[model samples]
Structure formats: C-alpha cells, structure tokens
Target: MKSLATLRAVSAPALAFVAGFMHAWAIASPLGGQPVWWLQLMALTLLVILLDRCRSATAAAWLGSLFATCSIGGSVWWLYISLHVYGGLSSAMAGLSVLGLSGFLAVYYALAGAVFCRLRPRGPAFRSCLFAAVWLAADLLRATLLTGFPWGVGGYAHIDGPFSALAPWVGVYGIGAAAAFVSALLAAVLVRPAQICGAWQPLLVVVLVVVALGRSHEAQDLERAPAVSVTLLQANIAQEQKFESATGVRDALEWYATQLMAASTALVVAPETAIPLLPDQLPAGYLEKLRSHFATGQRAALIGIPMGRIVEGYTNSVVGLGPGADEYRYDKHHLVPFGEFVPPLFRWFTRMIKIPLGDFESGAVGQSSFQWSGNRFAPNICYEDLFGEELAARFRDKAYAPTVLVNVSNIAWFGNTVAIDQHLQISRMRAREFERPMLRATNTGATAVIDRFGRVTDLLPRHTRGALVAQVQGSKLITAYAWWLSRLGLWPFWVLVAAVLTVAGRASRE
Candidate 1:
C-alpha cells in the first residue's frame, strides 16, 4: 500500500503536464490548427480533478503552474523561431525566453488553483462554481495585467464548439468561465459519484440549452448589409529581407503596387508593412502613382505602411487611398511587447536582438472606423483581435459601429508555423462575437474572408503571393456582447466573479 501511494504521488505531476499539453492542443491542434472543443473540456476536467485531489493549496498551486507552463509554452513554442532564427538570440537564450514568458503567465493559474483549494465548499455544485469564478479571475487578470497576452484562453476553442452561441452574449472570457464551471461540475460528479443525482440534471440541462442557442445563432440571424467587393493582397515577403532595401522591401513595393493599381474591386487591402519604407523614403513618384490611381477611381485601397519620421516617432499605420484620398488612416493600438515596444529595463534585451522598427507609438483606442462604399470598416493590426473589449469599444455608437472588420498582419516573423492558423482562429472568434465579417490580409498566409458566423468563405494558400478577391457582406445588427462590453468593458465579469466568490465563501461557512 505504501508503494502504491508513492506511485500515485509520482504520477500526479506527470499527468498534470500531459493534461496541459492536451489543453494546448484544444486551443489550436498542432496537427492542423483547428480547435478541438471537446478535448479542451476533457483536459480542463482532468485539471479540476487533479486540483480537487490535492491535500494542500501549495500542491494545487504547483500542479496548476505546471499545467499552465506546459499549455502556454506548448501553444507558443513557435516564438523560438522568431527569437532565435530572426531576432538573432542564441538558441538557448530564445528557448529560455519563451519558457520564462510562459512561467510568468502560469503564476496566475497557480494563484487560482491555490484559491480554489483554500475556499472549496462541501457541496459539489458550490465547489464547481467557486472554481469557475477563480479560474475566470485568473484568466481575466492574465489578459488585463502587464500589457495582457491572453493567447491560449480556453474560450477561443469554442468558436466552433457547442458554446459558440454564447459568444455574442458573453464574449470570450465569459465563455471560458462557463467552460470552467462545466468542467469543474463534471469533475465533481466524477470524483464523488454519490453527488451525481444532483449534478447530472444541471449538466444535462446546461448542455442542451447551450447547444440549442448555438444552433439558433445562424448566419441568417445577422442583418447583412450591402456586399462590398474587395481584393486582398498577400505578398509572400521573407521576414529576414522584409526591411532590406534591395530585396524584400523592393519586391513588396513592386508586387503590392501592381496588385493595388490593377484591382478593380470597390476596396483593396495589403498586408501589414506591405510597403516597408516610409512615405518620404519611397522613390519620388511611387507613392503618388498608386494614390493617383486610387484617388479618382471608384476603387479605393487600404495600404499598410510605416508612417511618421524619427523626430515625431514612427507608426504602424494603414493609409486609405482612392475614395478617402489618404484621409482615412488607422494606426495600430495594441503594440506587441518586446516585438513592437520595449518595456522598462528591456532596452538591453532589444539591443541584444536585430529587429528593425521595434518601437512605434500606439494609436488611440476606439478610433473611428474607415468609411467607404456605405460600409464602416474597422482595422485591427495583428494580434489586436485578441482583445475583444478594445474592439467592442467601437460599437458604443451603433450608428457608426463597424460593418466589416479588417485585420492586416505580417506574421512572417513566426515563419510558416501554427501561428498563422492560431491567428486565423482568433479572427474567426472576433467575427462571431460581433456578428461582423472579418477580412484578413496577411503577408504569406491566411488571407481570407470570414462571414459573420465565423465561417471562412475564401482563403489563399500559405507561402503564396496572390490576391483573394471576394464579395464580403457586412452585418448591421449589434450582438449582446458588442453592446454591453462596448459600454461597460470587462467590468461586468469582474462583478460577477466577485459575487460568485463571495457567495461560495459564505456557503462554505454554512
């Protein structure tokens, strides 16, 4: 019996690590980058069971940290390519950097697990609810604090999962909270079969209700505005040479210019930094020629370029040509830490690397959407779609809410990795949350058009240089998520989690 007990103790942490890896797969399967929602629930259920079995908060915290380290570290392992291969960090340093970031993020889950173990209630229902609240609190904190990189949040998996309908009503964090609650309830029933009588009914009802609501959230529910024909340019520029004056920069300029000038659609879009040089640095007539073509024709273009001078600070911006005549500009708001902007004391880190244009000023939150062809187009630079609340802010004034969402990205830094697929799923989730179609124009991959229901209607093959032309229909109706989150931000979730924790703590005393 002592030997058996020792074996169990030895195996528990191993199980936690495996569960975390599987959870990462659920976020975006390593095989194809598609989300496996059932896998996520199963992995999370295992996590809850592991936490429940812990005798002390310290053990639970350690287990949670291990789980998160495996999950987040596995999910973003591609960062190694960018850091070592591109940024010129040594292989060891790059790997250590990735692990360090993952470990830092895992601290939040460790705290959550400790809290769950400390305040666990006697009743299975109460315990499950308590776990859900704490899990959400941790997830929210991860997404909110220290510039917030919520990459592997469980909610992204539900884009095509049973809880998809809940997106428009509760947003990603809320869906993650619901998933946590359900996972914990299942774990509770499994751990204590005697409580199945009370737990099974709610579980069954919850599943049915979510499935029903999700089924009803069809494309038909979204009020489709007039269709806009768009030409999305994908210039397969190599990251190593993207900023090089002679090679990638010149190629990007020539290719995108040709496509933009020839595109006959109502609107044309190029990926982030399709033009590697600033306006003043461009060959004299190059910028004016494209602007002249777009300036008068009915067809306008949204071209991504580096704007501003060294004195005033540079900006990662998209300039509108054609109809708006450079009047409509959208600058990137959510700057990527380390990659886009250096944090305090990180100046040394940036100096060690060889990344150009590493720092750029941030654009204002809730900037005005681009107006053209009777449709409002909102632009979000790469990874900006991860923050739904920032996007939600644009929906505050319904009359001016974006009809079409545009994402311009150059993820070549990550190479032809799963980052492309993971980013695509993020865009799809954003589309479902707001009931608006997403137009993605990227350098090298996932240049596609996604409808309001988060269905990809068009796509360009990865590593290809081409144009994906499609008729994108916009949505006019505001989802419940867009309406409230736009007005209150993530404040309601804060209140809900606090209230749940309070109730759970009170019930534990009873």
Candidate 2:
C-alpha cells in the first residue's frame, strides 16, 4: 500500500487541476450556450475532499489556492475575447488587461483555499460543512466587498435548470449558496467510506428537498394576466458609422418605422440610441414622417435616442413618440463605468482610448416611469439590468408598480462576444427573481422577449438585423425577493459559516 505522505502529495495537485478544469468548463459551457456543467463542479468538489483526506494542512492549502485561482481564471479567456476581438484593443494590450483582471479576481479564490486548508476537519461531515461555508463566504465577499463583481456565480450555471425556482425566494446569492452546499455534499460522499453515514446523506437529502421546493415554486399556478403585444426593432447600426451622416440616421429610423408601423402592435420599441442624432437634430421632414405614421390613437412608439439641453448637459434618453412627446421620456439611470462616464481617478486615461461621445451624465435616480399605451413601464438602460436589487426596488414604493420592464441597450460595442449572451442570461435571472417580463432591444444581438418565469420565448440571432415581435405578459406582483433582497439567504449562510468556524477552531486547537 502507498504511504499516506505519497497519497497526499499526489492527490493534492490532481484535485487542484480538477477544480480548475471544472470552473473553466462551467463558465465556457454557458457562454457557448451548451448544456449545464454543474456535474463538472460537483466532480471537482469530490476530488478536493478525497485529496483533503490524505493531505497535510500545508499541502491542502496549496492545492486549495490552486483550485480557486484556476476556476476564476476560466473567465479570463472570455475577457480576452471581449477586449481584443470586440473592444478593438490590440492583441498585446488585450492579453495584458485580461491577465491583470484575472489575477485580481483569482485572489479571492486563493483566500478561500487558504481558509479551507486552515479549517481542516477530522470528521467527514464537519469537513464537508466547513468546505461549503468557507467557499460560500469567499464567493459572497467577491460579489459584495469592492462594488461587487458577481459576474460568474456558480448558481448561474443552473439558470435554466430546476434550481432556478429558488431565485424568487433566495435571489441569485441563495442559488449560489445552494450550489456550494451540493458541491460539498458530493465531496463528503466521495471522501468518506461507504460505511460512514455522515452528513453527506442528510445534506444530499436537504439539497433534493430544496430542489423539489424550487421545482414546485416554478410550477405554482401563475395567473394568466392580460398580454401586451410589443414590437422590438433591432437596427444593427454600426457605432462608427452612426454619426457619420444625417442620412444614415434617417434611413435607420425609416427602417424601424416601416417594420413596426403595422396595426396589431400596442407599443413599438427601439434599441438604445437608435436615432443617432439628437431629437431636434434629425432631418425636419423625417421627424414629420415619424409623427404622421405613429400619431394615430391606436399605436404609440417608444424610441431610444440621445436628448440633450444646454442646462442639463447631454443625456441618453428614451423618448415616447406618437401622441404626446412631453409626457414620456425615460433617461438612462445606471450609466456604464468607463463607457458612459469617466471615473474621477481614471479621467486622464480617456486620452488613450477612442470612444464616441464617451462622457454622458446619468439620469435622476428613481425617475418616474415611462408611460406608453396605458402601461407604465420601468425602464432599465444597458448595464442597469445587472443591479438586481436597485431595479426591483424602483417599483416597490409606488402603489401601482410599472406593468413591464423594458431594457434598451446597445451591445454593439462588444460585437458578437460572449458579453451579450452572459448579459442575456443575467436578464433571464432578473425576470425570474422579480417575476416581471423583460423586453430587451439591443443594437447588435439578443433582442428578445423574456416571460415572467425567465424563459426566452423568442430571440433574434446575434449580428443579424431584424424585428422580433411578441406578446409579453406583465408581473402578477412583486416577488418575495423584491422585498427581502439577499436576506433570505444571508442570515442562514452566515449562521452556518459561524458554526463551521467554531468547530474548525476547536479541531485546530486539539
């Protein structure tokens, strides 16, 4: 038989590699729009536990760090694609930029690994619980601490799966915690001998129960609400050529108007800044033509445009056309960090990068809803969709919340990169968590309609120019998560983490 030392040394690196590989696949698989990769993560967790059984504390720590770093590094490949291929950055600069970002994010995983090694448990049950707690804490920190970039949370892997039902109760963070719990249980089962009836069996049972509850919640009788037929116009206009000529703007506007001018639509939507020119700057005849086509009482058009005043500076505003122009304007609230407004510290860096009309001011927070065809819609422009709580809370204070959630975006900047797909996935999760149907109209791709349950009913392909028309249903009411935020998951997770830490401390002391 091999010595304990030999087994420990061999297993540690192997387990680390497995963890890295699993994370890589989990992130890549989703971006590629493939099948779920939760099994890969579970397998890696099992391998880690098995290695932990034979390894010393120092070896375990090293292996754990390796696992964490590699897992996060998986996203770096996509980051490279975004910067180099999509963002127009040079090959050398893109490589450097992605490496820097990946290294920074990987540090959180390294810390998780260190904590896991320090809390080495004697019992299989204790070890598994501790692993779940430590990893979850690290994941939470990654999302919360420094303006929180919760981009690749493990729970997102199950976005379309049975576990997605948990979104309404625990939000994405809760789903993430559940994923960690399941992974730990898998680890426990693999590490412990078949005779050991430890926490693994009970934990597996709990996971199943939670999943069943999620499935039931997903299936819970949803009342069929009145549907609103919307026409989403995807004008795949290139940003570089958007402002080159006034004729280009007129041609694009005419194209959208022609496609959506039919009588069946209650409201017609356009992508962000579809009208490249300012409201007043458009050709006088073209503006008149739009007014004549959409002015009738039967239909109203909501078009995204850049509207500005000398007093207010330039703003990315979505204007409602048709009957009353003054009554309906939804300015973009959460502007992108560097794309829309230059950060105070990085203001000087703007000289290096070339972006058209980069400095734009943000709209007032909690602005009034955009009114269209008797429906008050809560508008989320671009990156605002990523802030789940902020978007959900916008509807809470009012007696009657907006009936629909409209996201007007220009994903052309990222081209056909995974950025658009990842963005759509998050939008799907938000729909389930908020229980609101989301209508997205983007410049390049993924202009689609998402139902209240997070299902993508219909979507236009990326890089193609076309119109996607669908009937979308509004929310029945605000979901449980809309009010609770992450509280439903945070309290329970912290309690478990504290208990695990207590046990770990005692074990270390002994």
Candidate 3:
C-alpha cells in the first residue's frame, strides 16, 4: 500500500488536471459543436477544491499551475485554428505561434496557482473566500497590465446558462467568483465528516438564494427595455475573396442594399468591409442608390468599410450611411496585432505566414458616438468590443451615453471555429454589462441582435448568408457595471483583494 503522504501528493495534481480539463471542456464543449454540460463543469471544480484541501501547499501549487497551463493551452488550440485554417496562416507556423502564445498565457495561470497555494487559508470559509479573491485578482491582472487578453475567463463558460444573469451587476469577475464560491461550498460539504449536514445546510440555502436573486433581477431587467427594430445583414464572403476581389465588395453591397430595400426596418446594418470601397472612393452610382433609398425617410444605414488616408495607410472603419453617415464616422481604434497591423518585431516573421490586411493602421483612441433617429449609437468594430474599459469609456459621462451599441465584424477570418462563438459571448456580456442593446453585423456568421439583458433576440447561422431582424431596446440609464465596475469589476474587487491579502498575511503570521 502507498504511504498517506504519496496519496496526498498525487491527489492535488490529479485534481488540478481534472479542474483544468473540466474548465477547458466546459468552454470548448459548447463552442466545439457539442451540447453544453454545465453541471459537469461544476462537479469538476468542486473536486479540485477538495483535492487541494488534502494536499500540502507545494503540491496544491503545482496542481493549480498544471491546471492553469492546460486550460490556457486548450484555448490556444482554438486560436490556432482561427489563425491557421481560417485566417490563412501557414499550418505549421500557425500551430507553433498558438503553442507559443498558450505557453505565454500559461504563465499567468501559474502565477494564480502559486498565489493560491501560498495564500491557502487555515479556516475553510476563509480559504474559500481568499481563493476566489486571489483568482479574480489574477484574472483582472491578465485582462489589464499589457493591453489585456480578457478572453477565456472562467465566467465565459456560464454565458448561456442561469449564471449569466450576474454579468450586468458584477461583470465577468463576479461570475468567476460565483463559480469559485460554488466549488468551495461543495468542497466543504463533500469533505465533511458526516452528520454535520444540518450545520452547512444554511450555506446551500445562501447559494440558492443568490442564484435566485440573480435570475429574478435578469428577468425584471429584460422586461424593462422598450424594443426597437434592427436588421443585421451577413454577406457570406470567403476570406480569400474578401481582401482580393473588388467584385466581391460590389456584390456584397448590392446584396445588402437589396435586402434592406425588401424590409422596412428601422436600422439596417452590414458587416465589416461590407463595402470594400474606401470612403473617398465610394462608387458614385452606388452612393446615389443608397441616398435615394434613404431619401424616402424613416430608415438609417450603418455599414463597415475601409476609411482614412491611404497616404498614412488605411484604417478599418465603420461608416454610418444615410443622414447619420455625415455625422458619424467611427474608425476602429484597437487593431488586431497580427491581422490588421504587424508589430515591428514580428515583421520578419510575416514572410512565413499569410495574414490578410496585414498592413492596416489603427484609428484614434476613445469612443465615437453616432446620432441616429433620436438615439446615440456607439460603434465597436471588430476586436474593439473586446476591450471592456474602452467600451465603458464611451458612456463615462451620462450626457454622452450611447443609446445602443453597434458591432461590425468580419468573423470569417476565424472560419467556423469556436472563436466566433467566443467573440459573440464577449459581445453579449458587454451588452448586459452596459445594459445597452447590441446589434452585431458580421461577415459569414453570428450576425445577431442582443437585448440589454444579453439575450439574443435573433441570430444568423455560421457560414450562412442571411439577414436577421429583431427589436433591440436602447437604454440611457447607466448600468452598475458601466457606471461603477468597468473591466472585470475592478475597483471593488481590488479593495476586496487587498483586504483578503491583509487578513491572509495576519493569519499566516499567527
């Protein structure tokens, strides 16, 4: 028989592996073209906490590091498919790049693990809360401090489930905290010596109550919004054809116009690069056609196209057409690293891989709002919506708050991978966090109208060319997340982290 110490040592790593696998599996299962299994994810997390309790600090730390590394590594695999199979990167190079990226991200997870082990509490309740706080702090650090990569947070896995309701109030970090809380609570229950079920029964009640309250709040919030009509057009253009052929642009614009003409929608939108023509170089005949259609009144158009000076290089922009077109020209601020503009160091590496629009420039910083039919529309083109702070900055002052959010994207670069779905989830959370309706127009897939509560009013399927029409509500009132906690619910969370660390330090000394 093995020594008790050996079993204890093995338990931590095994549990950590299970946790990492479950976290990755939960995230991938939904987006990997499989049915979502949330209960399984919860069980796995609980197992990790229980195992951590049995192991030494060193063993727990190692396990946590392993889990963190694997989780990030799995996500990098999806990113590889996006860059390689879809974005046209060389298969070998793309795989290598993604593995490298996964390795880099795994460092953050390792940090989280090391911290969790070092700060592991003596009391069960203290330990659980401390773990949640530390993990959230680590997640916040990951999203901030180096331009941030807020993708693949633990909370994102709960986007479509009952837990999603918490996003508006506490943002993504809150969801993660909730997940951690649940796992810790389960650990406490499972590891109990028995017959003490009555003592811990109140904890379960508290969890149920919190979840119930979250659901109730979501339902009420959903009912509050006054629906506004929106139409999103998706032109299923292939990646190779999008950047190369001018005819593809002409056809896409014509198709979108024809679709808009058939329906009497309030707002009509087309995806990024829907009109491949630059702003100053828009075809005269096409401009006239668009002008004539809007002259009839009561309709506005927002289409994504290439804009800015060719002398300084092109900027990926979303130009609002019709009356609003003259008032608002939203140039995308955040350019994709390798996709839009190449970093100086990586310039030499570009020869090994193929990247579309690898020579584009970034737009000016800060949010630009568009006024349309008695509403302020904020545009987040492509990857700009991923930056939570950037998105919240637009409505920092209530006077300049946008009535709705518009995201124009070309997700065709990622093909049919989970990246598209993951992108949609981020957008959904943003809408709920800001309590603003979001209209997403994309090339290829996931063209959708999202409500203030993050519910999808309507959506177009991936790889399909279609139009989605739905009534999206607009909000002027600032959400708690928008007015208070932008970007992983930062301020309060930081304060909490400081307090937790202080208490943990005192406990360690004692």
Top lDDT prediction, candidate number:
1
Ranking by TM-score: 1, 3, 2
Q: Give candidate 1's error at residue 70 in angstroms.
A: 0.6
Each candidate structure's count of clashing pairs: 1, 0, 0
lDDT of 2 by residue, 1-510 (tens): 569777866766776777675765564364475326475457457645644554355555566556655666564356555455545678888777666665666676666666777776766666666766777777777765555566666666667766787888777767766666666666666656662577557676766877786776766666444677888888788755555675556667777767756636887888888877765766768656767777667777777888885345788888776676464777876676556778778776455556656777788656676666556677778767777756765656545566678888887766566667767877888888878888998888789998887888999987788888889877556567776652333455567678878879888888
Worst 10 residues of 3 by lDDT: 218-227
Q: Candidates sorted by lDDT, descending order?
A: 1, 3, 2
lDDT of 1 by residue, 419-472 (tens): 898899899999999999999999988899999889999999999889999999
Scored by TM-score, the top model is 1
Q: Write out the backbone clash pairs for model 2.
A: none
Compose the digit string of candidate 3's lDDT tens values, residues 1-510.
Answer: 579767966666676666676676565464353314374357445544644564355555555567766666665466676667755677887878876765566566566556667767655567667777777777787777656776777777776766676776677777777677656656655666452354266456646866876766655533233445778888898876765646666677678778867667777888888887666666668757776677567887887878765776887877666553354578788777777777778787665557655677766655568776667888888867877677887767777788889999987766677667777777887887788888899988778888777777788888888888887668877766787753333778889888988988788778
Better of 1 and 3 by lDDT: 1
The lDDT, on a scale of 0 to 1, for candidate 2 is: 0.69
> Candidate 3 at residue 486, lDDT?
38
- Alpha-carbon deviation at 417 in model 1, angstroms: 1.1
Alpha-carbon local distance difference test for all models: 0.90, 0.69, 0.71
Estimate candidate 3's alpha-carbon lDDT, on a 0 to 1 scale.
0.71
